[model samples]
Target: PQHAGISLLRVLLGFAVGAGAGLALGAAMGLSRRVDDHVRPLFTAIAQVPALAWIPLAMLLLGIGETLKIVVIAKAAFVPVAMNTSAGIANVPRALVEVGETFRFSPLQMLRHVVLPGAVPPIFTGLRYGLTHAWIALVSVELLASSEGLGYLLVWGRQMFWLDTVLVAMIVIGIIGFASDKLLAAVEARLQRWRTDGV
Candidate 1:
């Protein structure tokens, strides 16, 4: 559980920063054509770069610290959330916007009443994908930089030829990832219920 806790903390911290940034950026881009026009190309280019690709440069900069791990994991979590959020907002029905406009809703009012509620589903989808990505990245970074973690266990087991250790760690990682996914899914379901019931 110690090893598992380390991995979970790493994932949560990194994913929170990445997903928060993604949500903010995506909201701005979705709300304003100018922001999208300027940012989308850069976002697209960075999105194409794999999370692992940043490790060497990050190591050079941060020198194998926890900050490097967080940055690497954040990179992994950012793209899907941003893209999904942008798509979600863009896909908010035009009719709803028209109604909001007809009602003379202020910008904030329109966002609160129409855009956010519509965008939330896709944002949650993004969170799911981001969690998965963060999990993958955490293990990857841990394999390289950590002395003790499930990923490090995989590495150590391989070196010691302890196949059972490797297998057990792999199983633990899988179970944790699966459980986290289900937790997020349940939260999403509850949010959907709240929206449906107008809570």
Candidate 2:
């Protein structure tokens, strides 16, 4: 339980930073052609690299510390988020924008009434992906370099030939991942319902 808490904290902290940055970048890209042109190429290139590939470089720069783990996890969370968010916003119907303009809606009003609601579904999708990625990255980092967390428990148990402990940790990780996915799905459903119901 202590290990679970530690790992959860790491995921939450890293995810928070990643989500914030991703949303901002995605919003900018979606709203501004110039930003999209400048950033999209770099983002796509980085997204092609596997999360594990960052470990060696991150460790070199940050020395296997909590910062390294957080940075790694943030990268994992950031990509899907930024991608989905940009896609969602870019796909917002031109008809809706036209209507907003017809009504002379303020920029804030248009975003609040049209852009955000249109983007909610994909944004939630991004959240789900980002969270799963974050969890996966956290476990990987813990397994490779940490003295604690559930992933470390799995590694330690294996090293000590404690197969039962290793199995338990593996099971725990799977269960946690599944549960988080389901919870996010539920939240997405609720948000979608609210949108449909004019809430």
Candidate 3:
């Protein structure tokens, strides 16, 4: 239970960082073609590097501490979210945007009322993908470094030849990831329903 709690916290923290950064970057890219052209290539290149590739560098810079672990998870989380968000926002119907403009909506108001709602389904999809990937990265990081969390527990179990502990940790990670995805999916469904119902 203790390890489960720690793992859950790490997952949630990673989600928050990933989702926030992704949303900001996504919005920037979506709102400006110039910004997208300037940043998307770099973002794509960096994201192409596997999350595991960052472990060595994170350890060197952050010293295998909680910071390193979380940073890895966040990075893993951020890429998908940002990419998806950008795609979602950019795909928002031009007609809706024009209607917003016709109504004299400011840019921010237009985003809030038109663009965001239109983009939400894809945004949520990205967030779900991010959360799943982040969990995998976090577990790998914890198994290799750090001294707490379910991943660490699994590592410790391996050293002690305790397959049961390792099995338990793996199960817990899967369960948590599934639950998180379901929760997000429910939220997405609700939003879709609200949009469709014109509520």
Candidate 4:
């Protein structure tokens, strides 16, 4: 139970940090065409590297500590969210944008009233992806370096030849990931209701 509670807290914290950074970067990528053109290639290249590849560097820079874990999880989360958000915003209907402009809407107003709502579905999709990625990365990081959390439990179990504990940790990770996915799916459905209701 103690391990379970700590693992749960770590997952929640990882999600919070990862999601916040991902949203900020994603929003920036989505909103700015110039920024997108400038940074997209770099972002793509960086993302192509495996998440575990960064673990050693993170350890070197941040040491075997909480920061390293958080940073890794955040990096894992950021890529998908940013990529998806950019695509979603860029794909927003030009017709709606034009309509907003015709009504003399300021850029901010246009974004808030027209672009945001149109982009929300994809944004949520990105967020869901980010969360999933973060969870995976969190487990990996914990397994590699951490002394606590569920990932640690798995590693410790393996070291002790305790298959039952390892199995339990794996199951718990799957359950949490599934729950997060479902929660995001529900939110996405709610946001997308306008599509069918014609709002």
lDDT of 2 by residue, 154-194 (tens): 99998999999899888888888888889989988876786
Model 1 scores a TM of 0.94
Which residue pairs in candidate 1 collide? none
Q: Taking the candidates one at a time, how many backbone clashes does each contain?
A: 0, 0, 0, 0
Off by over 4 Å in 3: none
Tens-place lDDT per residue, model 3, 1-199, is: 9888887888788778878998899989988999999999999999999888999988899897778877888999999999999999999999989999999999889989899989988899899999999999988988899788999998899999999999989998999889889999999998778566876
Candidate 4 C-alpha lDDT tens digits along 1-199:
7776776676677778767776777778788878878887888899899777999988999998888877888788778787778788888999989999899999889888888889988888888888888888888898888888899999899999999999999998888889989998998888778888986
Show model 1 residue runs off by greater than 4 Å: 194-199
**Model 4 worst lDDT run, 10 consecutive residues:** 3-12
- The lDDT per prediction is 0.90, 0.90, 0.90, 0.84
Error of 2 at 165 (Å): 1.1
Model 2: lowest-lDDT 10 consecutive positions: 190-199
Q: Could you tell me the TM-score of candidate 3?
A: 0.94
Return model 4's CA RMSD, one decimal: 1.7
